[model samples]
Structure formats: structure tokens, C-alpha cells
Target chain A: MNKVWWKILGSVLVIYTAIAGLLLGVPRLPILNESIRNLYFHVPMWFAMIVLFSISVFYSVKSLSSKSEIDDIKAVESVNAGIIFGLLGLVTGAIWAKYTWGQFWSFDPKQNFAAISVLLYFAYLILRNAIDEEQKRAKISAIYNIFAFPMMVVLLFVLPRLKDSLHPGNGGNPGFNSYDLDSRMRMVFYPACLGWILIGYWVYTIRFRIRSIEVKQQAN
Target chain B: MKKILFSLLLTLATVQLFAQDNGVEMADKLRSDGKIYVVVLCIVIILFGLLAYLFSIDKRLKKIEKENFPKN
Candidate 1:
């Protein structure tokens, strides 16, 4: 976790994304136009969020077996970091929707499901705060987290596709891959996902460290 | 017969013109004027600034950890 190289690599990759994502050529779809560029900035946020939430679940499972406070801290801090990315995803998606889909908050299945999934994590945080006893809090919240993770996945990924969604790749609509995600866009999009995921992990580690420190300080 | 040939040529010329105008529009004007670079530079600067801040926080936390837990 303390390794510096990956953090530096992430920073460099993100900076590269900021420059290349804007300058690079993209598909010339009619409604999307230049806003197709949002693929680099917006889609990656959810990818990073999903990754961080996965890490949170892993730590939660560890906390359950080991009954360790440190593992609990890791779980909760990762959720906190993941929530930040999730919110960013929601806001960015809304802004993109406004211009392309003609509304900031279309009742699109994907958008609604995304919002609900983020709320699920919010409930996880609240669940933690509601409990006071340390061991009970860790154990119960870990169990809740394990359940929440799968629910989030289904809500965001599965339910949207099952219904009619204005968002791409849902319902009967073909995804960007079939139409707009040409090879040129992939060059920037893939790197953006990787870079943001790394940065999200970096943020999670920092939050974990700080929270662990606070726990230690409280003990002393 | 001559009139038919002339009208077919006219229609072909109009079709070519229509295709050119039908091309999808993008922010080509901004790119050509060189102002898109300004947006990119500003975003990069903000990204660097936030990253630097995060790094400093990480360093400070490391220092505090060492001081607080000397054995670990």
C-alpha cells in the first residue's frame, strides 16, 4: 500500500487522459457530438466506484472472519472513497444527459438504478453510525456490506438491462461499442478507466490509513 | 432525351452537396482556433493541484503514524 510507484503511474496516466481525452478524435454521432468526450471522464467514475466497492467487500469479508478492527476500518474507508466516485459519476452522468437526452434527470432505468445503488452505500454508512459497540458494529456492518455489494451490482448492472433504458447498452439499444466506441476512442477510454481506478485505490488507502490512525489515537 | 440527361447530372451534383453538409458537427471550430488547449491546460492544472494536496496529506499521515506507533 505504501508503494509510491503505482501512485506516480496513476497520476501520470490521469494527466495523460486529461490531455489526450480532449484532443483525440472520436466518433461523429449526431446527438453525442463532442460530448462523446464524456466517456473518458464520466464512465470511468463508475468503474472506479465499482472497483473500490469490490475492495470494500473483500475487506468486509476479512473483517467477518478475523473479527479485526483494522479490517473494519479498511472496509468502511473504502466505502467512503467509493461513494465519492459514485457521486461524481451521478453528477457527471446527469450533466451529460441534459444535453444529449434532453433532461438532467430522465427516468431512465440506468440512471434511476445508479442513484439507488449509491443510496445503498449511503445506507451502509448510516448503518455503521447507528451502532455504538465496536465489535458488534464491525461484525454487523461487515455482514450488511457483504449483502449490499451484490445488491448494488444487480441494481446497477442487471436491472437496467432488463428494462427499457435511455442510457446506452440497456434494453434493446446497442451499446457504444456497436456504434460509437471506435478504435480511436478506445485508446483514451481504456487508459482513463485504468488510471481512475488506480487513483481511486490510492484515495482508499489514504482514507484507510487516516482512519486507522484515528482509531489508534482514540485507544491511547 | 437531352433534357433527361441534363436533369440526372443536376440531381447528382445536388446529392454531392447534400452529403457534404450532412456530415456530423463537432467542435472543430474550437480546435482550429486553438482554444481547446486552454481548457485542457486548466483541467490539468486543477488535477495536478488536487493530486499534490493528496500527496501532502499522505506524507503527513505517514509522519503521524511513525510518531504514534514507534514499535509498528
Candidate 2:
């Protein structure tokens, strides 16, 4: 979509998210209470983070196979956005956990996994900076990016299920699967997720354009 | 697609278990008095507006470039 339309669509989605989140994100029902409402933001942030990181990995692969500068740019932008969302997800989740679990930072599988993912990307950025050759940097970064996805998948998805913890969905801990979400909450929750994902994409696009412009300016 | 379905299933189970718990009702009642939701709403609205504005400005720049430097 063009810029104006993107703004318009994004505005509408944000408005929708706000209204829906306020009405439903704060738990009012008999089962979930208020802490449950954090799902509107926490879960979706992580979802967007994963989606963006996955996109980065895809672009990294493309850049490797074709030696395309465009693919390299895309990989960089996606990873940058992914990191932002990942940090936000981590902070929001910590807050949610504090309220629900009475602790700020637990050594839970999910928490540790997320921290590792963030550190991995931090290394990715460093790798890019340490290299002077454009093609070499792109290739190496792509190789590193590929490794990131499996690490994330294992940390976020696999490890949590393998062991028991107080965190949701672990060790018989309550999670989205074990709990009964009301239909009313679902109405807003789905849209909230879509809105967040779209906004994430929107942010990525803007950053990508800016990066492209900077590259052009440098070349000229 | 399958993952989405699975996530949904997992979500359903979590919600079911939550609904069965007895203390949630009391917590909900107390939460309603806090009005934190309103703050969240306002923050989201502001963020949306800022991003939209930034995107529009970027679009305008591109349009200007296209107008000034047309390829023959």
C-alpha cells in the first residue's frame, strides 16, 4: 500500500485496538479477572516479534542465495523491527508477570528463552558492524540470521513444554490452552493481534524506506 | 495455519481453566475500580497517531522524488 493509505489503515487499526483493548483487555469476567487482560498486548507483541524475525531470516536466506543488496536491506530492517518488538514484549510480559506471579524477573523458561533471543540479535547487529566488505557482511549476517530462528523456536516453544514451571502453560501452570476465554474477549483479541502485526509491518516499511534513502544518498 | 489452530486450542484450554477458578471474580471487581484500561487506550491512540504521521511524511518525500526525477 502507498503511504497515505498505509497511514489511514494503520490509524483505523490502532483506534480499533485501543477501543477493543479497553473494553475487553482489562479482565472483568468471572474467570480471568484483570491480569488476564494483559494478553491483548503481551501475547501479540511476542507474536509480532516472531513474525518479524522470521521475515528477517527469509530475507537473509534470499540475500545469501542471490547476492542481492535489496534482500540484505530487507533482512536488516526486519531484524531491527523484530528486536524492538522483542524488547517491548519482554518488558510488557515482565509487568504482566509481576502482577500475576508477584515477581519481577523469574528464571522461567519463557523469560530466559526470550532473553537469549534478544542477545542473539544483538550479536547479529555487532557482526554486521564488525565487517567492512558489503558482500561479506551480508553473507555472514545471513548465515547468523538463519541460526537465530531455530534458537528462538526452541527457546520459546520447545523448552517451555518440556518442563514444568509457574509460568502459564508449564508444569500444569494455567495458560491460554487450559483456561476458558470468553467469546466477548475473542472479538477484540483477534483484531488486536491483527492490528499489532500490521503496525509492526508498517514500522518495518518506514525504516526500510529510510535505510534505502540513506544508502542512495551515500552512493550519490 | 496449523499453528494458528493449535494456538487457538491452547488458548481455549487456558481460558477454561481460568474460568473454573473461584478468585477471579473478586479480582475482576477490584480491577474495574483502577481504570488502567483507560490509560492503555490513550497510549495506544497516541502511538497510532505518531506512526501514521511519520508514514505520511515518508510518502510525501517519495512523491516529490518521483515528480522531480522522472526516468526517460
Best by lDDT: 1
Whole-structure CA lDDT of model 1? 0.92
Tens-place lDDT digits, model 2, residues A78-119:
889989999999899888778776777887777887889899
lDDT (10s digit) by residue, model 2, range B1-72: 999999999998788577757534444543454766557657876877787676677777677556544561
* Chain A accuracy as TM-score for every candidate: 0.98, 0.91
Question: Which regions of candidate 2 deviate over 4 angstroms?
Answer: A1-7, A25-32, B1-41, B60-72
lDDT of 2 at A151: 90
Candidate 1: tens digits of C-alpha lDDT, residues A161-192 = 99998888899888888988999989999999
CA shift of B19, model 2, Å: 35
Task: Please tell me the TM-score of chain B in candidate 2 relative to the true structure's chain B.
Answer: 0.50
- Quote the lDDT for A89 in model 2: 91
RMSD of 2: 14.0
Q: How well does each candidate superpose onto the true structure, as a TM-score?
A: 0.88, 0.79
DockQ of each: 0.56, 0.19
